[model samples]
Target: MTTVELQRDLPADPERVWRALTDPAELAAWYWPERMAPAVECDPVVGGAWRIASAPDGTAVGGRFLAVARPLSLSWTWRWDGEEHESVVAVTLAPTAPELDTPDGTRLHLLHDGLRPEDVGSHREGWVSCLDRLPAHLGADGSERA
Candidate 1:
Protein backbone atom coordinates (compact mmCIF):
# COMPACT_ATOMS: atom_id res chain seq x y z
CA MET A 1 0.00 0.00 0.00
CA THR A 2 1.07 3.57 -0.67
CA THR A 3 0.09 6.92 0.72
CA VAL A 4 -0.69 10.22 -0.91
CA GLU A 5 0.04 13.29 1.12
CA LEU A 6 -0.59 16.92 0.21
CA GLN A 7 -0.46 20.26 1.96
CA ARG A 8 -1.98 23.53 0.91
CA ASP A 9 -2.24 26.89 2.61
CA LEU A 10 -5.73 28.29 2.41
CA PRO A 11 -6.73 31.94 2.72
CA ALA A 12 -9.23 31.31 5.46
CA ASP A 13 -8.99 30.45 9.13
CA PRO A 14 -9.28 26.88 10.28
CA GLU A 15 -12.88 27.37 11.29
CA ARG A 16 -14.00 28.48 7.87
CA VAL A 17 -12.00 25.83 6.14
CA TRP A 18 -13.41 23.25 8.50
CA ARG A 19 -16.90 24.20 7.45
CA ALA A 20 -15.95 23.71 3.85
CA LEU A 21 -14.83 20.21 4.69
CA THR A 22 -17.71 19.08 6.84
CA ASP A 23 -20.70 21.05 5.73
CA PRO A 24 -22.81 19.35 3.12
CA ALA A 25 -23.61 22.58 1.31
CA GLU A 26 -20.05 23.78 1.54
CA LEU A 27 -18.71 20.48 0.25
CA ALA A 28 -20.87 20.75 -2.81
CA ALA A 29 -19.31 24.06 -3.69
CA TRP A 30 -15.74 23.02 -4.26
CA TYR A 31 -15.21 19.37 -3.41
CA TRP A 32 -15.09 18.01 -6.90
CA PRO A 33 -13.35 18.21 -10.22
CA GLU A 34 -14.17 21.25 -12.29
CA ARG A 35 -17.23 21.14 -14.56
CA MET A 36 -18.90 18.34 -12.62
CA ALA A 37 -21.76 18.92 -10.23
CA PRO A 38 -20.98 17.38 -6.86
CA ALA A 39 -23.58 15.62 -4.80
CA VAL A 40 -22.14 15.72 -1.31
CA GLU A 41 -23.74 14.75 1.97
CA CYS A 42 -22.07 14.47 5.35
CA ASP A 43 -22.97 14.30 9.00
CA PRO A 44 -19.75 15.80 10.32
CA VAL A 45 -19.62 13.53 13.34
CA VAL A 46 -17.73 10.48 14.39
CA GLY A 47 -19.42 7.30 13.13
CA GLY A 48 -21.43 9.36 10.68
CA ALA A 49 -21.50 8.64 7.00
CA TRP A 50 -20.42 10.98 4.21
CA ARG A 51 -20.44 10.80 0.49
CA ILE A 52 -19.31 12.81 -2.51
CA ALA A 53 -20.65 11.50 -5.70
CA SER A 54 -21.22 12.66 -9.22
CA ALA A 55 -24.67 14.16 -9.45
CA PRO A 56 -27.53 11.74 -9.88
CA ASP A 57 -25.55 8.69 -8.86
CA GLY A 58 -22.90 8.84 -11.49
CA THR A 59 -19.65 8.00 -9.77
CA ALA A 60 -19.67 7.93 -6.01
CA VAL A 61 -16.96 8.32 -3.42
CA GLY A 62 -18.04 7.64 0.12
CA GLY A 63 -17.08 6.46 3.55
CA ARG A 64 -17.91 6.40 7.21
CA PHE A 65 -16.23 8.90 9.44
CA LEU A 66 -13.51 7.53 11.68
CA ALA A 67 -12.62 10.74 13.48
CA VAL A 68 -14.27 14.13 13.49
CA ALA A 69 -12.40 16.74 15.41
CA ARG A 70 -14.25 19.88 14.47
CA PRO A 71 -12.21 22.72 12.97
CA LEU A 72 -9.07 20.64 13.29
CA SER A 73 -9.04 17.18 11.81
CA LEU A 74 -11.09 14.55 10.01
CA SER A 75 -10.42 10.96 9.03
CA TRP A 76 -12.51 8.46 7.14
CA THR A 77 -12.49 5.30 5.13
CA TRP A 78 -12.58 5.88 1.36
CA ARG A 79 -14.08 3.82 -1.43
CA TRP A 80 -15.04 4.61 -4.97
CA ASP A 81 -18.47 3.98 -6.43
CA GLY A 82 -17.82 0.71 -8.16
CA GLU A 83 -14.32 -0.16 -7.15
CA GLU A 84 -13.04 -2.74 -4.79
CA HIS A 85 -10.07 -0.82 -3.40
CA GLU A 86 -10.52 0.80 -0.02
CA SER A 87 -8.34 3.34 1.70
CA VAL A 88 -8.20 5.81 4.55
CA VAL A 89 -8.07 9.60 4.28
CA ALA A 90 -7.14 12.02 7.00
CA VAL A 91 -7.03 15.81 6.90
CA THR A 92 -5.44 18.24 9.30
CA LEU A 93 -5.82 21.99 9.58
CA ALA A 94 -3.80 24.65 11.37
CA PRO A 95 -3.05 28.32 11.32
CA THR A 96 -0.35 29.40 8.94
CA ALA A 97 2.61 31.45 10.15
CA PRO A 98 2.11 35.18 10.29
CA GLU A 99 5.03 35.79 8.01
CA LEU A 100 3.65 33.32 5.55
CA ASP A 101 0.14 34.69 5.48
CA THR A 102 -1.71 37.99 5.16
CA PRO A 103 -5.03 37.81 7.08
CA ASP A 104 -4.50 34.50 8.88
CA GLY A 105 -5.12 31.25 7.09
CA THR A 106 -5.18 27.51 7.43
CA ARG A 107 -2.46 25.10 6.51
CA LEU A 108 -4.32 22.10 5.23
CA HIS A 109 -2.69 18.72 5.14
CA LEU A 110 -4.25 15.63 3.65
CA LEU A 111 -3.21 12.03 3.80
CA HIS A 112 -4.68 9.20 1.81
CA ASP A 113 -3.23 5.89 2.88
CA GLY A 114 -3.49 2.26 1.95
CA LEU A 115 -4.08 2.81 -1.74
CA ARG A 116 -3.16 0.18 -4.25
CA PRO A 117 -0.05 1.19 -6.15
CA GLU A 118 -1.99 1.53 -9.36
CA ASP A 119 -4.39 4.15 -8.04
CA VAL A 120 -1.92 6.75 -6.79
CA GLY A 121 -1.62 9.15 -9.68
CA SER A 122 -5.29 9.62 -10.36
CA HIS A 123 -6.06 10.18 -6.72
CA ARG A 124 -3.30 12.74 -6.50
CA GLU A 125 -4.62 14.53 -9.52
CA GLY A 126 -8.14 14.44 -8.25
CA TRP A 127 -7.16 15.88 -4.90
CA VAL A 128 -5.12 18.56 -6.57
CA SER A 129 -8.06 19.57 -8.66
CA CYS A 130 -10.32 19.73 -5.66
CA LEU A 131 -7.92 21.76 -3.58
CA ASP A 132 -7.29 24.13 -6.39
CA ARG A 133 -10.92 25.15 -6.32
CA LEU A 134 -11.20 25.43 -2.56
CA PRO A 135 -10.11 29.02 -2.27
CA ALA A 136 -12.94 30.23 -4.45
CA HIS A 137 -15.46 28.83 -2.02
CA LEU A 138 -13.76 30.69 0.81
CA GLY A 139 -14.51 34.26 0.08
CA ALA A 140 -11.65 36.67 -0.36
CA ASP A 141 -12.48 38.56 2.83
CA GLY A 142 -13.11 35.37 4.78
CA SER A 143 -16.44 36.81 5.79
CA GLU A 144 -18.39 35.05 3.08
CA ARG A 145 -21.25 32.76 3.89
CA ALA A 146 -20.56 29.15 4.78
Candidate 2:
Protein backbone atom coordinates (compact mmCIF):
# COMPACT_ATOMS: atom_id res chain seq x y z
CA MET A 1 0.00 0.00 0.00
CA THR A 2 1.11 3.54 -0.66
CA THR A 3 1.57 6.05 2.11
CA VAL A 4 1.06 9.78 1.72
CA GLU A 5 2.88 11.92 4.23
CA LEU A 6 2.57 15.68 4.52
CA GLN A 7 4.16 18.22 6.81
CA ARG A 8 3.05 21.78 7.49
CA ASP A 9 3.99 24.54 9.90
CA LEU A 10 1.16 26.74 11.04
CA PRO A 11 1.21 30.09 12.83
CA ALA A 12 -0.69 28.79 15.85
CA ASP A 13 -0.05 26.91 19.05
CA PRO A 14 -0.61 23.17 19.41
CA GLU A 15 -3.85 23.69 21.28
CA ARG A 16 -5.34 25.82 18.54
CA VAL A 17 -4.06 23.52 15.86
CA TRP A 18 -5.45 20.52 17.68
CA ARG A 19 -8.89 22.04 17.88
CA ALA A 20 -8.84 22.83 14.19
CA LEU A 21 -7.98 19.23 13.56
CA THR A 22 -10.46 17.46 15.82
CA ASP A 23 -13.42 19.78 16.15
CA PRO A 24 -16.27 19.01 13.78
CA ALA A 25 -17.30 22.62 13.25
CA GLU A 26 -13.76 23.73 12.62
CA LEU A 27 -13.32 20.83 10.20
CA ALA A 28 -16.46 21.71 8.27
CA ALA A 29 -15.07 25.20 7.77
CA TRP A 30 -12.01 24.11 5.79
CA TYR A 31 -11.69 20.34 5.50
CA TRP A 32 -13.47 19.96 2.18
CA PRO A 33 -13.34 21.91 -1.04
CA GLU A 34 -14.24 25.56 -0.88
CA ARG A 35 -17.95 26.49 -1.18
CA MET A 36 -18.96 22.97 -0.22
CA ALA A 37 -20.74 22.64 3.08
CA PRO A 38 -19.81 19.16 4.14
CA ALA A 39 -21.57 17.75 7.16
CA VAL A 40 -19.17 16.54 9.79
CA GLU A 41 -19.43 14.48 12.99
CA CYS A 42 -16.34 13.84 15.05
CA ASP A 43 -16.12 11.89 18.29
CA PRO A 44 -12.73 12.75 19.62
CA VAL A 45 -11.86 9.69 21.64
CA VAL A 46 -10.23 6.37 21.08
CA GLY A 47 -12.66 4.03 19.32
CA GLY A 48 -15.05 6.92 18.70
CA ALA A 49 -16.53 7.29 15.24
CA TRP A 50 -16.55 10.13 12.75
CA ARG A 51 -18.07 10.85 9.38
CA ILE A 52 -17.95 13.53 6.69
CA ALA A 53 -20.48 13.93 3.94
CA SER A 54 -19.30 15.51 0.73
CA ALA A 55 -21.51 18.38 -0.27
CA PRO A 56 -20.60 18.34 -3.93
CA ASP A 57 -21.36 14.71 -4.61
CA GLY A 58 -23.07 13.50 -1.47
CA THR A 59 -20.43 10.91 -0.84
CA ALA A 60 -19.93 9.93 2.79
CA VAL A 61 -16.71 8.91 4.49
CA GLY A 62 -16.63 7.33 7.90
CA GLY A 63 -14.03 6.13 10.33
CA ARG A 64 -13.30 5.23 13.91
CA PHE A 65 -10.58 6.74 16.01
CA LEU A 66 -7.81 4.27 16.67
CA ALA A 67 -5.84 6.48 19.00
CA VAL A 68 -6.34 9.89 20.53
CA ALA A 69 -3.68 11.88 22.30
CA ARG A 70 -5.17 15.28 22.83
CA PRO A 71 -3.20 18.23 21.51
CA LEU A 72 -0.53 15.85 20.33
CA SER A 73 -1.63 13.00 18.07
CA LEU A 74 -4.63 11.21 16.63
CA SER A 75 -5.03 8.17 14.45
CA TRP A 76 -8.06 6.68 12.80
CA THR A 77 -9.30 4.11 10.38
CA TRP A 78 -10.64 5.63 7.18
CA ARG A 79 -13.06 4.34 4.55
CA TRP A 80 -15.56 5.77 2.13
CA ASP A 81 -19.31 5.72 2.65
CA GLY A 82 -19.75 2.33 1.01
CA GLU A 83 -16.29 0.98 0.63
CA GLU A 84 -15.02 -2.04 2.47
CA HIS A 85 -11.35 -1.40 2.10
CA GLU A 86 -9.93 0.74 4.87
CA SER A 87 -6.99 3.06 5.22
CA VAL A 88 -5.32 4.77 8.13
CA VAL A 89 -4.78 8.42 8.93
CA ALA A 90 -2.53 9.73 11.67
CA VAL A 91 -1.77 13.32 12.65
CA THR A 92 0.97 14.52 14.93
CA LEU A 93 1.56 17.97 16.34
CA ALA A 94 4.64 19.47 17.93
CA PRO A 95 5.86 22.85 19.05
CA THR A 96 8.10 24.70 16.63
CA ALA A 97 11.58 25.70 17.77
CA PRO A 98 12.57 29.32 18.21
CA GLU A 99 14.85 29.18 15.18
CA LEU A 100 11.98 28.39 12.83
CA ASP A 101 9.96 31.01 10.96
CA THR A 102 6.90 30.58 13.12
CA PRO A 103 8.77 30.13 16.35
CA ASP A 104 5.80 29.57 18.63
CA GLY A 105 3.77 27.80 15.99
CA THR A 106 2.91 24.13 15.68
CA ARG A 107 4.34 21.58 13.33
CA LEU A 108 1.64 19.38 11.83
CA HIS A 109 2.45 16.03 10.31
CA LEU A 110 -0.07 13.82 8.53
CA LEU A 111 0.31 10.28 7.33
CA HIS A 112 -2.31 8.55 5.22
CA ASP A 113 -1.50 4.97 4.49
CA GLY A 114 -2.98 1.98 2.67
CA LEU A 115 -3.94 3.96 -0.39
CA ARG A 116 -3.60 2.86 -3.97
CA PRO A 117 -0.67 4.44 -5.77
CA GLU A 118 -3.00 5.93 -8.36
CA ASP A 119 -4.97 7.73 -5.67
CA VAL A 120 -1.95 9.33 -4.02
CA GLY A 121 -1.70 12.44 -6.17
CA SER A 122 -5.30 13.48 -5.77
CA HIS A 123 -5.29 12.83 -2.03
CA ARG A 124 -2.09 14.80 -1.63
CA GLU A 125 -3.52 17.75 -3.49
CA GLY A 126 -6.73 17.71 -1.49
CA TRP A 127 -4.92 17.47 1.82
CA VAL A 128 -2.50 20.24 0.92
CA SER A 129 -5.35 22.57 0.08
CA CYS A 130 -7.23 21.76 3.26
CA LEU A 131 -4.18 22.18 5.47
CA ASP A 132 -3.34 25.50 3.85
CA ARG A 133 -6.69 26.84 4.97
CA LEU A 134 -6.23 25.73 8.58
CA PRO A 135 -4.17 28.74 9.64
CA ALA A 136 -6.88 31.13 8.51
CA HIS A 137 -9.45 29.02 10.30
CA LEU A 138 -7.36 29.43 13.42
CA GLY A 139 -7.61 33.23 13.05
CA ALA A 140 -4.08 33.62 11.87
CA ASP A 141 -3.12 36.81 10.00
CA GLY A 142 -0.19 35.19 8.16
CA SER A 143 2.24 36.64 10.69
CA GLU A 144 4.33 35.02 13.39
CA ARG A 145 2.45 34.43 16.60
CA ALA A 146 3.58 36.70 19.44
Give Cα distance to truth, residue 29, candidate 2, Å: 0.8
Q: Where is model 2 more than 4 Å wrong at Cα? A: 140-146
Residue lDDT tens for model 1, 76-129: 999998887889999999988778853588899999999999899999998998
Candidate 2 per-residue lDDT over residues 1-146, each given as its tens digit: 79889999888889888888889987888888656778999998998999989778878888999999999999999898777889999999999998998888999999999988887898788788888888777774344475
Q: What lDDT would each prediction earn against the true structure? A: 0.87, 0.87
Ten contiguous residues minimizing lDDT sum, candidate 2: 137-146
* Clashes found in each candidate (C-alpha, N, C closer than 3 A): 0, 0
* Clashing residue pairs found in predicted model 1: none
